[model samples]
Target chain A: MSGGYPKGRIRREDLISAAAVVYGEAGYHGGSLREIAKRAGISHAGLLYHFPTKEALLAAVLERRDAEDADREQLGVPPGLEVLRRFLTLAEHNARHPGIVDLYSRLAAEAVTPGHPAHEYFERHYRDARHRVRDSLRVLADTGELRPGVDPDEAALAFIALMDGLQVQWLTTPSEVDLAGALRGFLQTLLTVPLQP
Target chain B: MSGGYPKGRIRREDLISAAAVVYGEAGYHGGSLREIAKRAGISHAGLLYHFPTKEALLAAVLERRDAEDADREQLGVPPGLEVLRRFLTLAEHNARHPGIVDLYSRLAAEAVTPGHPAHEYFERHYRDARHRVRDSLRVLADTGELRPGVDPDEAALAFIALMDGLQVQWLTTPSEVDLAGALRGFLQTLLTVPLQP
Candidate 1:
């Protein structure tokens, strides 16, 4: 993105990054396009040249975040025990990127209204994320990793819930809550059959 | 609060409720005092007469919600595994209150920024909530109800995390997520040495 004279694409990336900060702080409805333009070091019309509408800009921002996350996280990591291990790593990653976390947390909460802009995006994200989690648990359960009577689907949802809940605590009080350690302790209790000494 | 006109307190309650709805929909930064006043069917001056500033109104709304939550949830139902069981019931209650959940979820996310108005409030809330959860786990650990090697503090934080995380998911997609059932499964794994049948 740096070496070439692809000024148009660079301008687009700059706008998206600034928009992420604005939307992260002020929320989608609260954030203004003009503010995003100002933050990105461009005029309002310059921003409009790149992104014709707010909705378009928002979609681009989300798409870029997804791409960045996939590249950073290797989203295709194998399931089962790796999912458990990656849960810790993902929390660690989120801890470093407060801007993305704040943007996501704000949008997800607001999007519960069904007609909100990010509603469909979040609906799909959660459904897919939960499916992967359920598959991972089912894989472990098949190998007798889970204790008797622990439903794979239930464990998957609860594990996801624990991850989300710890994230909220971490975002609010970083020093007091250790997201990975807390999650590890939870996994220890859940997988008591001793995969570890 | 209605008939004879100790209407001052009633007016305050009405304003707070209206503000909650506004904040829940538009978020804290997006919502305006004028809108809250309009929603409450009172003049802007009259609203401010009750609450001198927007921050004052926000504080009042949060305080009232706290009072309502305490009154509704039997926060003193004895500790131990009973605390674990009560977690399920609390989630059930939250399932019915999407307004509070939406308002809380949005505020909690925004408050992650250190300077946000609800920042200190949420920091204190998690600290206190985690401490209570830890104390409850300690009570159970003393009775040998907890599985060996389950750290009381860590388990407490994880349990709290699970509850908060579950609430967010439930609020977003109520039909797919079973808040209570998922919680019960997590607790079963945590207390798996079977102090019960």
Candidate 2:
């Protein structure tokens, strides 16, 4: 369908986008593979040819989201306060993309159940997110940008929590909650240096 | 059956408990009244008699939780740093009751979809929660217990987000996340005095 793009690859991408919307609205538990296939304009058997199970499709969906976010934010580049700033920029990006935010928030909550298909995915995702945030905090601590007496690990956990928790509130009441502003306030309290770069 | 409790009232309570269990595990969209009825040892029609719709049952479940928390914490009493202390205590209680926490986190995330039955309920719930937290912060500010330059409203939002976000992380990896400790650390940064009362 496209220059140098295979038809199968395009179909797989279509399925992932459709799955994201279905899962975003009804959640994984409420969403069904049949519905996802319907949205993707494919036969159920054809969808199965690509993803043998709903769980497999979910894994792909999650991976695609992370890869896209990483590419957009330059996730690991220029680590330190810069990484934290990238997160603020990401939060701003999230404000404009409520669908992705909804999908993430819904799935993360649903995945807390021990045996949910995506439980392990979210567990690892958060662990990685925490590590990234903590790594940035450690860099700031070494550079004297972090305030005195702040624990890097604890601050890392808190910062991740703030970003996640703020999304839920912002989604519910968009007019009242300012996602990046709250994050900036929390960062300002934790850092001795200016965040404006 | 022996006490003065009426059969109808007891049946209603039983249905509510069963509905909570079903809705907690499967969320409102994925949960069914028939299953809830079966769990309560009643017919579907009987369950419907008590909770006209699934949405009605969800409302009852949410209200019961808030009523229980309010009763336990004396929500409006003291009205200052003491209110904040009650929240810390509530967080401790939530750690011991992961089921309630799971139910809440799941429902809150699900309710973010506009037109979700619990949408308005959560909107009002968060509004009330923010006002309560902000009211306490205002009290602390009046007495100079709050750190200088901290905005009460912003701090209140961050605190709520922290607690909500921490619960998700704690639920996912209970061994890694310390719910109350992170919260206390955040409060320590905002307040001049110890929260050990």
Candidate 3:
């Protein structure tokens, strides 16, 4: 019932958050467990106590990120445009967490391997996210907020594509691309509802 | 100037092409000069005869891929929907060579480092591609192909973002996501131009 934990134990979630920062900054191949431990202000032994292996640590980092994102978005039904607005906001906010973004990119590339540990996570993430977006558009369609004849599935795919694509650009050249603005404009033009007034 | 190599020595261009394939398959970190030489059907010394070091070989691989892509796309002139069409073709064709896609994804992630070899290539790539797309949209605008008051730059950015984003999906779940179809639909809808209806 309570989220509280023992005072002495380095909380697993805190260790994962710190690891995410390190992994994001240094990349999966470049990051070191010692550095993550240092960042969390804990001994390496303490860090290992929470995550027995580097892979476990990385997995925890990704899960923690997803949980945090879910928490921020409230993970419930909402208006179509509102859902998009919240998604864009979360994406922009994610930009500040360079570690998580970098980790996401690295894991994405690795996911190409059929047996990669993160492959299922990414696959399920995209599938579920696409369905969520499609459902939102369906709601909009039902409410007459969306123009008739629009394919909700295609629209959902486009939205997902834009998010993934912009993240690459943002990672490549963060200064030049305005992730949120571009998404807002693109969605406004694509969808019936205006993303911005 | 002789286009053909004289004698048994492998041409530098040939060596670079082979290296691209090897690196594309194994990744910059996972790949090695030995593997590249093996793939090229040459001795280690012969491989070094072209690219002196592993880093140099990696750089050559990325450079060759860029040059090949540019040459294929014909870097200078503005292409209209043809550009998107060509991109889709290339992406679909690339499905046969998963190595290239894997290499690109890997390099893109590592390209975050300012001094990384692929950094400049991707930066100029995005900028140049953006300009080309924008120019194409300008042509569309002048011919009244786009809806009135549509911003070409924003449209171009969105198009590129869509391509980048969908590629992630294509790479992740090629079976489920029809990348080219999704892209063509999104572009047609965004530009309000009928695609050979």
Measured against the true structure, the TM-scores of the candidates, in listed sequence, are 0.92, 0.96, 0.86
Candidate 1 collision pairs: none
Which candidate should be chosen as best, given DockQ against the real structure?
A: 2
Q: If both were scored by DockQ, which would come out higher, candidate 1 or candidate 3?
A: 1
Q: Which runs in model 1 stand beyond 4 Å of their true positions?
A: A1-5, A192-197, B1-5, B192-197
Candidate 3 lDDT over residue span B99-132, tens digit each: 7777777677667656776778888878877787
If ranked by TM-score, best first, what sequence of candidates would result? 2, 1, 3
Per-residue lDDT for B24-71 in model 1, tens only? 999889999999999999999989899988888988888887777767
Can you list each candidate's DockQ? 0.72, 0.88, 0.60
* lDDT digits (tens) for residues A113-179 of candidate 1: 8878887787787777788878877887788887667677777787778877788888898888887
Q: Which window of ten consecutive residues has the lowest lDDT sum in model 1 chain B?
A: B188-197
Q: Which is the better candidate, 2 or 3, if ranked by TM-score?
A: 2
Which of candidates 1 and 3 is the stronger one according to lDDT?
A: 1
**Shift in Å, residue B147, candidate 1:** 2.3
Q: Which stretches of candidate 2 lie over 4 Å from their true place?
A: A1-5, B1-5
TM-score of chain A of 2: 0.95
lDDT, residue B141, model 1: 76
Say which candidate scores most in TM-score: 2
Error of 3 at A100 (Å): 2.7
Q: If both were scored by TM-score, which would come out higher, candidate 1 or candidate 3?
A: 1
